[model samples]
Target: MKRLWGTECAPAWRAWLDRATEQIFRHPDCGAVERELLDHLEDKATDLMRIFPGLTREEAEQRALEEMGAAEELGEELARVHSPLVGELWQLTRFLIRAVLVVLAVECLWLLWKFA
Candidate 1:
């Protein structure tokens, strides 16, 4: 993925972001979360580089990822935060509401026809 810093991310960074957001339910939400994570990674890497001028960009990025901890664990936490159950429930509620509205519209049409 391309970084907000206007540079293409390394394959390792891409892989990490993938693993980190794989568990998120919604694809759009996953993208947003990934961007946020990438921003944090970039900030951390920049800070690291500033702190240690001897560190290469890749080295700083690697250290930033390490400091962020395990991707799997972060993924699980993100998954919980972006719960599929809530999204599913909202979808169901919308479907039910639309169904009810359709039923009422049909009934209104029927009444208008009968009373005409």
Candidate 2:
């Protein structure tokens, strides 16, 4: 089960948090992901802080794994909401343009109906 995680559960939690943090790099506007990651880090850090006295980073991360769930689980949860556009900015831009067009069309229709 631990091998199913990563290098080690100790490093794995940090790596998972880093990966989640990287999601912010991809979508800086994702408040939800950022909040979740921060909360997860804080909770795990506190748990580690409580369990082992003077815990190092490794010890903290390991304790985090026990309380915070697996990296795979975190990844899966993020994947559910991660609309990672990556280098597909063009597609995202196009989608935005289409959405704006629809809104404009709706507004135009509303104005015409009101005037008539």
Candidate 3:
């Protein structure tokens, strides 16, 4: 987490990023987006410190998060671009599909066990 600036900035940065981008993406995409945003935040914090000497790491990260805008606004914008139809329907669809596949696999395994 602090591999770049020698500061534990990841916890703060990730907390904010998760609150910001959590609802915009699905499982894998959400992890990717979080990593990307964390990298950006770390880079921004480094840049801020470079630009203004005397700025602490925490100060730089806070400024960067503020500059990134409110979480709700960013989340909504990302949701619009990534999933225009971000709702329970998508969640339900994925859940149902997985559930059916799991049930089928279980049934197949049961049949095999019974036959054997």
Q: Rate the local accuracy (lDDT) of all candidates.
A: 0.86, 0.60, 0.73
Give the TM-scores of the predictions, in the order they appear.
0.69, 0.40, 0.60
Q: Clash totals for all models, in order?
A: 0, 0, 0
* Model 1 clashing-pair count: 0
Please identify model 3 stretches exceeding 4 Å from their true place: 1-9, 84-116
The candidate that achieves the highest lDDT relative to the unseen native structure: 1
User: How would you encode candidate 2's per-residue C-alpha lDDT over 1-116 as one tens digit per residue?
Assistant: 11221222334554666554443334443445545665676677777788777898766766665666665566566665565664367578889999999999999999999999
Q: Which ten residues in a row have the lowest lDDT in candidate 2?
A: 1-10
Candidate 1 residue lDDT tens string, 1-116: 33342325777888898889889867656778888998999999999999999999999989999999999999999999888787788789999999999999999999999999
Error of 2 at 97 (Å): 16
For model 1, the superposed segments whose C-alpha errors exceed 4 Å read 1-7, 88-116
| lDDT ranking, high to low | 1, 3, 2
Q: Write the per-residue lDDT of candidate 3 for residues 62-93, one digit (tens) a residue.
A: 99998887877777777776673554577789
Quote the lDDT for 9 in model 2: 30
